[model samples]
Target: MNANGPVTAPPTTGPPEHPARAEIDAEENLLEKRRRLVLRRLKQFLGMAVAGTLLLLLNDLLLVHSSAAPSLVVTLGVFFTALCLSYQGRARASLILLITGVLATVGVVLWLEQGIRDSAAVMAMTFPVVVSAMAGSRPLFFTTTALAALVLMAVALGDITGLHPHHVRPVRLSALISLEVVMLAVGASIALIARDLRHALHDAYQQAASAREARRQMEALAFLDPLTGLPNRAAMAQHFEREAARASRDQRRLGVFFLDLDNFKTVNDSLGHPAGDALLRQVAEALLSVVRKGDVVSRIGGDEFMVLVPDLQSDLDVPALADKLVKRLTQPFHVDGASVTATCSLGIALYPDDGHDFAELVKRADTAMYHAKNAGRNALRLFNEDMNSNVVEHLHLLNGMRQALEHGRFELHYQPQINIRNGDIVGCEALLRWREPGLGLIPPSRFIPAAEKSGLIVEIGTWVLQEACRQIKRWDDAGLPGITVAVNLSSVQFKRGDIEQVILNALDSARLTANRLELELTESLLIEDSERFSGLLKRLNELGLTFSIDDFGTGYSNLGYLNRFDVDRLKIDRSFVHDICTDTHHQTIVRAVVQIAGSLGMAVIAEGVEDQATADKLLELGCELGQGWLWSPALAADDYAAYVRQQGRAAPA
Candidate 1:
């Protein structure tokens, strides 16, 4: 089909994009059709009601009029009026009009029956008045006029032949003229009022219609997310519940895709939140282009979207649509005058295969999405039950891990950072390890994301900090060495301003010096509330605590703000270290950071060292220290302490 305007997207397939409209024209069309239908019904009802009332009154009025011809005219007028009211598309008020027509016909017949004797009577004046003014309805009024003329001919013919002019004299034409003036004035006034009432009724119906439309719009807005214009979690749940029942009844296939934007936070941090929101809106529009009718899309997370597609008979179509969505979203997004490409990771789950219920399917989809990100993003993953063994087992491990923390089931393992030249143990970074009753060693990374999401990090982080402080204090008490302990903080914990108090509580609890503890933070932490964070950093510095920038190369780095915040060290991310010796660009960046740190009177440490050449190159390049698998792949707390003692014994201090 031909599209209006040059179509920016491929026109042949998928859903249409809605440019935010003042009115949803498609829904408006449905409402307009319904409204007109309702008006037609109302008019038909109005015609019937008025016509019924007039028919009932006809026989009673005709009995007084006496003349069979006049009574016959009255009865016929009422019957026709009732028939017209019963016809389709007649309004109730139109029935009132039918009544008016019956009245006019009756009046004309009465005048004819009374002859010239009663011409001066109200009924005679009324007959002519009604005949002249009932012209609004051409067919009925004309028929009444023609019949009235016949009745007038019969009456005039009878009067000319009457032998005795008992009830009448030579007809007074002047009196008839006076009666005509009064009747015309009365009829015009009644017609004017009726016309005014019709206009008022039309206005009322229009206002009622406008109110109904506004109500629907308000309801729509309530169920939709303002940012994305997609259904929210509440709306999605409602829709899913309804669709699930329908699908179950029909035995159709249902699919849910949980989509998460990859590296979205990095974009938000680097470009500012305004740009991030624009990116989200653009992504919403992009997703809209991939959903068909009978499908729903919802925003369930800050950067996550849920899509529900139903009424499929087979799984073949589900994958194809999911593939289409991934392709469409993985394409570039132009936002805020910048052409930035963003990739969405899709986790697909089908009914009965992935889950038997709505929430279960969504959960499985989420699990698949988590794996998608870990397996490298910009891809789609179908949820598999066999994979759930690993995930379900992993969740069990995580839950056990949390319980262990609650009952002190975890312990700290520290690795020392040695002074290579002097062979002295300076400080150790504290790592967490879980020894389950059945399973073996579990790493921090295996459960940390879950910890952060579950708000368990606060508890785990506190334990690590306090335990590391106690270890430092124990080493000092044994007269082994003066060394510092570095503790990693999660983003959630760091945002807690009372983290200083937590540190102090640990210090006081362990009876350790503040100078011997160093706090480590990554580049991602720098994105929110920089000024407030800088204040916290300075405050901690004043309390005799030191700060280090951890995993520096992985985030948006502003070298301009180093000395301003009194940072003591920069830890290079391991990604750059993997190719530093071979890649000139990588080496240049490392060298520049090393020199910049040196200039700022701060130390630099490169993490993830695996070979001697890289270590030699870093020392040659004026790097302060190195840590990673090349030296050791993390050791137990006791092993680290012994290594520190043995190395300190060999140093020529």
Candidate 2:
């Protein structure tokens, strides 16, 4: 018993619920007790029948009375009938009747015999114990032995009190009590042994169940990624190999996507580690929110997740997935007290075209992701070598632009932000143009997207902010104009948390009012960290700095989301403007974009107005501003200022 101390009948702590399992276990326990109760009653009844027979034999041997023989015989007949009934069923009622008959007969026989130690009455005392053991009920055997002992003691005490005296001598009384004690002691020992065996069996079953539960928990832990509760690398790889094999045999297309969160580390740095972890979980949920039941999403590494699309075909169905994922990520996430914003760049590598093997497919997807990161954050790009060459050239340009930023080859040009109705210059977007000593007058598009990819836009954008501030300060000093200089924001620049501080730094340096500088972003930029990005915009927006989304229709084009953002103008994309004069389809699209922007109280600027026809049509369509080669392409800072001066002289009042 010292194995854990006296195996204290393990407390039934039950289970942890208001609806405990005790009632259930207890009901099973009661059933067994009731079954034993029936067995016990039958054993007692059989014992009584045996006693009645033995008593009749002794009474016949001692007396020559036919009356006593018939009385004993009648008692025997009654007990025999009871034993038959008890053996068949109704053990409780039949056995109780047998017990009452035995006690009364024993007392009456003793009084008639003057308390002699007769075989007749003594037989009744042994019958219950002997028959209980024969019937295989150890508890009943011990209980019967105890009851017999008590009955013998009562007879002995009755004799002493002279009330229905049946005891004759001290020796007879001592002998009967001694026999009863011996029988009880032996029977109780057997019962104690049986109870111990039953308890040991119960303990073994519980231990086996506990071990099985522990095993299941360990197996689950092996598959789970602890932080996000998504599948880990090993589980994901095993799934990949299984699905890849199935797809190969079935001739189904498989899509492997490598998703990297854009600038997630910035949130970790700014908001502390706990907030970062919460943000990551929120992102994981958003990524999988629309996933169907059979699809799988896994966290492969820090800030990188992998998706396996097992059955796919690349028509309208497959190409549509990339656009939907991009849209899902643009919605702002709220965690803790902060409304966090995040975006993911998706890179796709199709089966067989990318690779027949898992490792090869993953590598190609990784290669595609590098190209997507080169394009900009919040964008998706498929794997192709031609895409990489352009990606390589763009990165090279940014590396050169970094060197140029330090040596000073960057210059800004001002293009008029004009009123379409009057054709008067209202404000100007300060555009950057480069004149490298080796290459003359390089365009902004070739270098700007590169600057964004390389994260050099934050610095270059800061330069533009300060330059525009300085120029507007100069114009005010000359009393030539007091107008806003709208500057374009690259996506990378939009990601910076310190964008407001960058503007504040510029405004303080150049001594220009915050009201005179406007920040413009593409609609694609609106799709990233809008909570963080929009907060930065609103801070500047609150300072009277204007906000506009450039290339509006070229983005995901969710006009519903556009109304939720803080902006002053929506610049109609140049692609639409280029074809609006020729294509009726393009005209319809332009009209829709213009109507939506105007309905939201955001002024529409028509970009790429290369001829009078395009500008006149934009004005006819009720656009508020136009900018393109119709007037001038982006120019050098000094040259544009001198040209503006010359244009003012050429103007007729």
Candidate 3:
């Protein structure tokens, strides 16, 4: 199943029954064998013909007193030498020599001695028919047979008149007629047999060819993707292995890229699968067009492809190539009469640099690809040592998160959100903090994204919502000042279509009023289709639950949604706040956001106020609510309760 070796279909040549080469090669072998068989038999028969003719000439010279013996012997010797010396494997040359030797020796003796009355000369003509039959050529057999009959008839006419050299007796005339009739019957039969044999060979070759074609089709199915007409993962694996070895031997660089189409599932879900398929085909063609002739591009799985860059000039050039390929793939594709653009993230690893072998290289490339996706899609990353360590850390964090959730090793910290005008802790954002068994106090930044990507965010987010609700309800029952407790929700949670139910369940189980709980969602969440998500927001709002737009002014926002939906507050992103004191643009954006909120009759909260100057500017800007280290860092539930009690007591009565 690991196809990282040579996957190209090799040219086939050999016997028909070879499992790899199949029937075409076998048919070729059969033809060669037949040709060699005919050549060998023809040589042996020619030697016999020469020896037989010499014996006949010697008999005529020593005993029969045949005057044509000398000329016939000389001609037969010359033709026999030519046949033995010149006919290598050419059946045509052998056949021609056979006919020439037979006619010259037989005709000379027949005309010089008894013409058509000579039985020996007539018998000598039959050898050529046998040789021609064995050559497996029907046309040659028929031609040789017809030539022998014509010569015999010519001799008969010469013997008919007194002008003939030998006298034709009536007793001998009937015997010569019988011999000629038998020769014609034998020659005709051999020709018919050769013709049938040729047909049978032709039929067999055709059958073998058909079977080979079928096998080739099966191989194509096994190794290629039908939709893209590209090699599959199995083929890619095979190609990688072979190229790796060749690269090592030749001291060449080989680059392997792990590529994944970004947001392809959204296209499939929004459009139809047929559109997605057409888009994939277009992508494959684009990728192939951008790569080198020696490079291989394969579709390993859904929305995932690999490009094997063999014979690279240098490992340093891989990034440039990868970038070019990514750019090519991101071009707009016209599918189903609609213009659609899909980008890809690629991770590249070179042979002997990232890994010495296929598996190792692919693993590194895959790791790097994940990093590229995390960094943001439509990019490429070359494998590095840090990526490996990050991979290890990510895996450790992912595994630890699962166990932490199960054993209640995770806890929530409350960061106080104070009313800037009155200096009262109006509410607190419930932030998640993890304390692993050994690794203490893991930040939300480190594991939150990982959890979301791994789909553990759904469970983790649910726990956060429920635990925060329960803790706040306990605070209320203990007679402490009640404040709105906000739990941040990941965009992934909303995708489940059951986020509203989850929120209701947490509030009901905690016996807390819906109005006391606030759910925070990022600006990206609002960027989604308003019609699809607006209903859920309205339903949640009907339950007296409120919402805040978190990390505002950091992403593309349809600011109209703030008013269209029941948004109560906007938390200015920390990036703008961190630089607001120094950067005019940040200050202007903050002022604009505050103005926009005030016009819409919504509360605005600014976070990351580390100093009094920044806090004073927010107050001057009409921002009412804010939280930062200026108050205190986020605290555990018990610590937060103590802090709240302490702050209440210190307030002037």
Candidate 4:
């Protein structure tokens, strides 16, 4: 399987070179080397054969004038047959046949002439040994050498015993000994040289193999994710370039899907890093399973993956792929005997439509992915121009917020929480408001998300806590009625910021009671790590601080945590309260919350109550406290102070 593509099949080979192809190439190279060796030896043999045949013909017809024609013709026939065998690729057989024929011809000449005393016949015996050595076969070279020695010994014995009818000259012992010594030296020298050549060839092949392996490993390290074995960002970029070029040439669409696992950090924190790694690997598998064969799936670091879908027939094909990914990823993954369910937010960008380059496409896809996350995770969003505008605005807002935090342009507004039955201002929820120099008052909805995303919310939340405490002290100094001041806590502040320390510092510096400062936390934040948060809540509760679930019923309203943490209040979110007077669904939710809160000995406060009828309905539903336009919108510090004083004077004791 290719790392650049889907990993549904087990990897049989890596990139750049497949094992089977490399093996075939190596086999072909070896065969070519053998072919060259055989051809070179055959050429040498052919030259020697031609020269020997001509010399024999000349000695028989022009010089010696003996009838050696039959012997010469037999030699020619043997040479032709060897040449035919070599051409048919039977190199070893041809070599053996050629050596045998040369030995037979030389032995016959020695017997017919002076036997052991024939100088030319003894010299001719060296041909078979030399040819075998040239063939690079150690066994064949040694065998031919031994055969030549036996042939010499036989010729000497036959001559000495008068077994050769044609032997007329007596063999000289010194001449025979000198010839045997020369043949032995030549054969040994040739054998040693052949052995050295083989060793050098072996070493060269080994070095080449090592270099190839090193290059393959380097490529794997550069392109593949260590954990998931998927193509990483660098490989993805290369794949994108190739796919993009093809799409442009073919006039086809290419979709880039950027995937981010929702609440992945929570998974790491809850399941530990090992389990998180396992989860990521499983996610990679699921992604590969969803994509087509040619599509590319890459792990772009830290729970983020990119899928490049090429050769898209039409835009209609994109959503089906995206939906498949979302559905497949949202399913439960079993890791270390634990069933962990993960949902991914996917953002898609099309080639030549959303972006023209890899980086631009990825950026746009990332922006769209964040939009999917913001639209509530486990969804897919296609890249659009408006998302880019929103992204630009978000960047501007993020930058502005950073500046505002540094320049002290951020402030809090107090919205009065009224008692539904007595019309008394029971408490006021602190709302964060930003006043930029030229932009006027920037609403929380527009900038709060940007702040949260940029991690400025932690510092900003600290400021809100400190400022709310100071204002509460200022109101007490002004001799106003003592009421709880509720400040909203961001999940980021709770997780990353030292909330307990910041709260303690604020209350201590302002000399305000902790109970008078209520921390409004969302249900999702509380349920994230309940056991850890339970301990923190317990510690804060011991410090005489009050805790309320803000924007209740808008999240996973798990009552198990409410009882576990012992929360003091549940602030009903404005959505249900806005239509509680008429919408039966909203009314039912309110009633359920009121009943649940009442059973748990917790106070329920309704937010976004705008009229007397809504307030009356909340009161009728057993909710006594309400905060909305019914009493007053969130006001400035001075306005809230004046409003409190007026409410105190107007109320009958």
The most accurate candidate by lDDT is 4
Each model's Cα RMSD? 17.1, 15.6, 15.9, 16.2
Q: For every model shown, what is its TM-score relative to the native structure?
A: 0.52, 0.43, 0.52, 0.53
Tens-place lDDT digits, model 2, residues 419-497: 6666666667788977688788788877775555445578888888888888877876765566577888777775643
Regions more than 4 Å wrong, model 2:
1-195, 213-236, 242-354, 358-414, 419-424, 431-483, 489-502, 521-542, 548-605, 613-625, 649-653
Provide the global lDDT of candidate 1 against the true structure: 0.67
Candidate 1 per-residue lDDT over residues 1-653, each given as its tens digit? 01011112222465645645534775687567544543443344334334432432353254333343454455455546545554544433444454455445444544443454554333333443342333244665565566556655555666677732224434344345434543554455456546646865897798789989988987876777766667777787787788788888898767788999997898899899978987887787777776776678788868999988888754345554665676577578877787888887888777756767777888989998888788778766778846335434434444465468768778887765655444355566788888777777777777776566444577678888888888877876777657777888888887633677889999999887788888998777766767878888888899889888899877878875675677888988888888778888888889988888888889888887788788777777777587776656677767776777666542211
Across residues 159-226, which tens digit of lDDT does each residue of candidate 4 receive? 67777645455445433553554455445545655765897688789978998998999898899887
Identify the superior model by lDDT, candidate 2 or candidate 4: 4
Total clashing residue pairs per candidate? 10, 1, 12, 0
Off by over 4 Å in 1: 1-154, 159-177, 188-238, 241-384, 387-401, 449-459, 473-481, 495-501, 508-513, 527-529, 574-590, 609-616, 628-633, 645-653
* Candidate 3 TM-score to native: 0.52
Candidate 3 regions off by >4 Å? Answer: 1-206, 217-239, 242-354, 359-387, 496-498, 578-585, 611-613, 648-653
Enumerate residue pairs that collide in model 4. none
Candidate 4 stretches greater than 4 Å from native: 1-201, 213-387, 477-483, 509-511, 649-653
